[model samples]
Target: MHTRRPFRTLALALGTAGLLISGCSSGSSSSGAASPAQAASVSPSPVPAALKSYYAQHLSWRDCGVSGFQCTTMKAPLDYAKPDGGEIKLAVSRKKATGPGKRIGSLLVNPGGPGGSAIGYLQGYAAIGYPAQVRARYDMVAIDPRGVARSEPVECLTGPQMDVYTQVDQTPDDDAEVTKLSGAFKKFATGCEKRSGEVLPHVSTEETARDMDMLRALLGDEHLNYVGASYGTFLGATYAELFPGRTGRLVLDGAMDPSLSSIELNRDQTAGFETAFQSFAQDCVRKSDCPLGTTSADEAATRLKKLFTELDAKPIPTGESRDLGESLATTGVIAAMYDESAWPQLREALTAADAGDGSGLLALADSYYEREPSGEYANLMYANAAVNCLDLPPAFATPQDVTKALPSFEKASPVFGEGFAWAALNCAYWPVPATGTAHRIEAEGAAPIVVVGTTRDPATPYHWAESLADQLSSGTLLTYEGDGHTAYGRGSDCIDTAINTYLLEGTPPPADKKCS
Candidate 1:
């Protein structure tokens, strides 16, 4: 779910919730404590005088066009190590409790993007879609992390350039095709360096965790109460690791394990998508209108791969200028796997694409890119790559690396393996080295942290939640025995009640609780 392209859009479905719903500290200061190198570390020292100015600076809130939502901006150090070096502005938004009870405090919500706009999520979903009791007692809040939307966003390719990049053949048959794919990756990285090099180095989840603490202090919350989905779960975990004592009522839905290397993460995610796709195929075959043959899931998968091959050989024409090539078609299929609700759309898109009309699949791919009808795009994909590339080393350092690893990737996912392996190459061309490495996050001394996982979550795998929960000292695992990218506010009343109880009553559900 946390991949660079279509995976980044996992938060989109969760973000449309008004209708639906919505690290480490510095190191070396404590003996026997997990070092920064071992986890998403946070600074242990008290706020420095220079940084105190930023932490204490007052925000000027104003109407952000969303009724009942007040927005403001906060300043954070571009480099946390150098508090006085330079500053970055983070966009913050809040909707006060509509209460029939005493206000508890601010409940900060982030829809995982690493690149997703928390402020946009706050105003659009969390403000109105959360449970009434929880909303009545908590100030719903969100902050667009630095380099995300409304913040000083990271920008890379223009719409046209992105279209070309997205359409590039991913499953290359030979060295020339591989080179072309590599060139596309290089182009994307080069664009980021040219447009957002300065902010690129500082957009790691570790930096964003520190920013969250500052927002926490500014909002006067003694403890940080939060709900983070997908990549946001990683952010929440990082914050807990950094400020364990400050963690309160945290719910990490669609959790990610920070301990996996880039290759491992990519492999696991590829397998996850395969798992989700299998589930989709099983359901699809049962439906009469399944485009990928109406036999077994395995047969459907074969048909799907055949479609990719066919598109690779001969791109389907969309009414729009963009045609449905292998890459775009794959992305469209991947997009639908994020949520089951989109399955119908995927089926329709596939049916149309098979009929030589590619508009449906192209539209789905565009939605995955957060592309506007006018061909403009949001900063989602740009920021996704920026943060992902900076946070960890590239999954593959070269095309040869991808070539060598192709078999294992293919074993993990026969349908998506080649493309994902190639897509993982994007970070290889990054202008900067990774700022943080993968490590276990125990978040020692933290309060009970609820980690929620959907069994069939395509983006963030269920086992990841288990791994993360096991790593956190106070982590509790809550399983939703169902499908989707996230569990909370997604129509599982059981999941919702458990999360709401923890948020409002400061009591986590049973450590091994499972909700169907």
Candidate 2:
């Protein structure tokens, strides 16, 4: 279980993780070392005999305050190696099938924040918005991973503390600014250690993957049928690697390669965001109201870069205690890169920011942070760092390392690269050492899994999907020749039809299948 982890103070931008290329590219990442012993294998160690009770545990479900949904709590060992030492409870939710057709069991959904609340995703969007045919045939299910919302969430900074963290200058110009940013990182890590002391080490993606398996067995499913997006893809793939024989109908949209080192992950994601911005810029320039200007994409990029520089010099007002600084502004832009649907709002936000009213961009930044009107934030960022820091070693152990990587990062995206390089340093100050390493995951004997990729996906690059498909022995590549993060359920009938067919009928699309 591995993926990208950006600056928490900036809402985990630049997509997630460094990934394995073809043939489990033998590469070492900031994630410790690429040891074969740590690498995921087709033959995973069997369930420990001591953990029989966990496998046999029962779920007591009842109305969870939400209409048409049932909620339950699940118990699993906090540390797998010490099953009896302690246990953690995971939050689970499900909406039973509408049932106009034959039931096809539970369809687990995870919208990949790594720290994202799968339960929230299920209730908020997936339960109501999925295709009627699919919803009617399957019970929509989700389990908020440990240390995520509704679970034993990981807490770091308070709302006010986080507010200050968010405005930290990502593109530092002077030694003082760099030291200030480093101090902020240290504060955040120290806070999490003080606040979420117990669960930090156990929140790795691998742990969440095991949690998913526990859910699968508790639900009485012989095989896991899951739709995982972004970092969720890494979780799903890890499950397949750990329990290949029990995996079924896995759809990994916006997939993450399990083999990425921290440096590769951050660099690749920076480039990925650049690709997404290029698409947005091209589209924005076609309209007269383009915020960056109705000019060539290159010129638009130059203008956006200039704006970032200007914001770094002096943040504009957002009519709030916190101003729209470069960090927040960049986060706002990166948030829109995840979905084309948000592009219009991004354009409008940029238009407003350019005119000295930073409110719109600030609002966009708030959305990225999942900030509520009351100023409280969701646990997404805290868990993101908790899991990511545990999943891979820091990309750079010192600020000097980041300075060394700056040239390469800048080459990736001149507009966003410098900030991203600095942002990558966030994990360096993690309270605990990384428990995981950059390794390959090949679910050798698993059922054919559908891997979906959006060509211009800003966060999880299309190449990642390609590499993931190639990594899994029984993988099928389903390409959506379009933009955005994930392809399915994004208005592409061709992509959705293929996924729906696989979920409903268990027949994956043909090799080299392409959708627009």
Report lDDT per candidate: 0.82, 0.82
Question: In candidate 2, what are the lDDT values of residues 1-516, reduced to their tens digit?
Answer: 012632211222222111101122122211111111112234444667988899888777766766677777799999997888899998887888898987777889988877877776777678887899999988888988999887899999999999999999888888999999999999999999999999998998888899888787777666788999888889899989888877878999888878889889988999998998999999999999998888799999999988888998889999988888888988888877777878888899999999998998888778777777788888878898888889888999899999999999999998888888998898899989999999888788888899988898877888988999999998899999988878888788999999999898888999879999
- Candidates' TM-scores? 0.93, 0.92
Give the TM-score comparing model 1 with the true structure, all chains together. 0.93
Highest lDDT against the true fold, candidate:
1
Candidate 2 segments exceeding 4 Å error: 1-46
User: In model 2, which residue pairs have backbone atoms overlapping below 3 Å?
Assistant: 3-17, 4-16, 4-17, 17-265, 18-260, 18-265, 19-260, 31-393
Q: How close is candidate 2 to the true structure, as a TM-score?
A: 0.92
lDDT of 1 by residue, 81-151 (tens): 98888999987778888889878888888887667778767766677778899889888888888898878
Clashes of each: 14, 8
